[model samples]
Target chain A: MNNARRNRSFLTDEDGSAATTAGFVIAGGLTFILLAVVLFTDVPIIGPNEGEMAPNLEGQIHTLGAESWTNFELYDEVDGTWDAESNPEAKWFLIQFMDTDCPHCWNEAGPMSDIESNFGDRLTMISVAVSLNIPSHDSDREEVVAFQEKASLMGCNSGNSDCSTRSGEPHDWAYFDDLDVTIMDTWGVQGTPFIVIIKPDGEVAWNQGQNQGQEIMEALVEMLPVVEAA
Target chain B: MILSTTVVLVISGLTILFGALSRTEALRPLFSTLGLGSLVDEPISRRMIAGALGGILGGILSAVWVWVIQRQEIIGSTSLCIPGSGCVAALSQGSSNNLPFTGLEFGLFFILLFSILGWIALTLHLDPKASNALRLLSWGRILSGAGTAVAVWMTIIHLAFVDDSPAICPVCLVLLVANIVTFAQFHLLYTSHSNGSWNDK
Candidate 1:
């Protein structure tokens, strides 16, 4: 009779219901914990807001945002000089973000020569050596020289793998600056071969990674201060 | 490949957890507190990781597609990584690898690496205690999971093709293969469990 009575009491108890409630509470608590981690750090599920203004790029004036493109100060290693800023008449900029060690960039010297020939006075090209881990200045200069020669560039190619034979020569490009990686953090240009052509007004008249040679060249021609005679 | 098995397990686990959280209205408030749904609906919670994988996998797959597009004329990407070629020396691109061949080499490597490693991390993080299997094993459900990966890979290659971009990856195609193997396992498990014939099956 005692055993039977004990069984009856156990069946009537609220432990099962209490356990269910406890599990629900635990799930609830964990949900809050994950949310806490998410709120502070980046979480994919909660994407960054869209239509938000892009962050300002470092090493360039924020006002450049108002225009299609902005100018960067470039220093010539060989001439030990600086490229002049926009010809008040300059209307387009061919901006290239490259790495000194890039093989593709080396190959690009050939096409680049073709591009200069094709566009002539209509384009103002700018190329930046963007690297997070900067090397010695002399080494960087050598790499640039090596890059030109490897690609058989005019004034660059002297038929030698070792660039020591020919001194580094600056292309007709108007600007050359080391990449400000902070600009990558700010504008999020993490990848290399990133290029943008800004108009006289400083708007992104043309932009994409490298390999868009034709498109970039065409955009520059269209944006030039020079107009075709009817 | 057995590498595919692991991807299936993790994705299946995620699907179950997602379904349960969505249905039990109470679960949402807690997830919201954790900031789970700020970027996408709760449905796409794992998509960022998935999207990154898509890019990687797509590059790997593009090897074969690129080989096809280039015809038998050439066996490599236009920009190759030969020491003399300068494709691999710098520039953040994958090796100036030839397609299909590099695809097989790097493809298998990354697939094994990504599939196994990704599965381990996902399993550890996925809330197993919270899953609701009954909510996630429909015919359509499995297909959607596989489709998400396939679509992402195709889109990347499409862009690459249009841009004449180099260094294609086969990440998405391999990931899709991973998803297929994974979903099949889930189907097997769900079927076995539901029939109460798990022991025999």
Candidate 2:
């Protein structure tokens, strides 16, 4: 009996052609839009934001620290004067960009000193502190002075080690005391513990943070052979 | 990274425009999917969903991005993508500093905005296929809740580790927000907004 009732027409007499037509139109429309956006931005200038020669930093770089950095002139600690010329010296130069207030940087100072001492013959480790938003020359000196004083206090004097309390790691004071701190920027840093590795040709090899011990070690070991041959 | 981000941005932008103008009802879902939920309603849930989805998408995007950068064959030990270092450093890089708004943090905002557009459309039963105006949000309002989280993540990677300086591509950030927003939108639409309206126009 139920089967007999079900035999009745399921649809009303109307054909409902409009509904079917609407469905087809929607399907076609959807296909077209997806296709359009997919192709448009591919135009040379509009789509991809690629800029000139992968800028020392990507084009948007207003500030350069960590790995994306290079400068024509620099200051020398031993001579206590400006280098004026950026020389493509040793096979590799470990340039660490530091700031006056960076505590993480001080923490990495030990490993950095180790990198310098162990590889001193083969590599050169130097630090430059850059500040942000402080452009005037006068303010620049004050910033540098403040940074140097802080560094001296940390490096030369043995204190309560409040700075080293975080990890209970021993502070490397003497090493940093010998090395000079140059102010690369004024006011403050865009970010810190900014370290860069430059190749003999003066190209930035790597841009990154601290504690890259094994990574740097392995790289240096492999690199020595190539440098020796050249 | 650049190619993938570009491709998705283009696809989504065109589909969004199409959704606004198309007359056909059947095509709505496909275009809407590409739009990723321009048809639902819900503020909090949408962002929560977008941020969560953005994380997964960010992971995929990161992997693909690192692969492409590596393929460039630029010789140097890339610190960010060197095995153990990978894009994980982007997390740390965020801590080192702050960049003025670069539009990358807009992902979560996009999610919320998309969801809100869906909510109002569903509630009003406007043209089932209507497209919303471009979303506008203040930095402060946008940064309020979930945007803060994405910002935090982006901040860490940008400052402590990653390069390209927290340059948040608007398209990728929008797409990222859309993915999660759409997922939540579709789910809520089917469950709650369904009987409410579909052909209200």
For each candidate, the DockQ is: 0.02, 0.04
- Candidate 1 lDDT at B197 equals 26
> How do the residues B1-201 of candidate 1 rate in per-residue lDDT, one tens digit apiece?
224333433453344344333323454454554465542443322332223233323322322222222221121122222222222111112222223344433223333333332332232124321233233334323553454454445434433532234433332334444454344334443454454322131
Q: For residues A1-230, what per-residue lDDT tens digits would candidate 1 score against the true structure?
A: 99998876664344343334534544454445335433532312211122222221223211211322243321100111112242434444455666554445544555666666676465556565555453322224335433433423332222223432332333545323354455444445556556666443333445564335556566655655555455
**Segments of candidate 2 deviating more than 4 angstroms:** A1-223, A226-230, B18-93, B96-170, B176-199
Interface RMSD of each: 17.2, 14.6
lDDT of 2 by residue, B114-165 (tens): 3333333222232222222111111112322343355455444544445544
The best candidate in terms of lDDT: 1
lDDT of 2 by residue, A32-129 (tens): 53344335323112110112111121111112112222222211111111132443234455656654345565466566656756676666555554
What is candidate 1's CA lDDT for residue B47?
Answer: 31
Best by TM-score: 2
Model 1 residue runs over 4 Å out of place are: A1-90, A132-142, A145-170, A209-214, A219-226, B1-201
Residue B79 in model 1: lDDT: 27
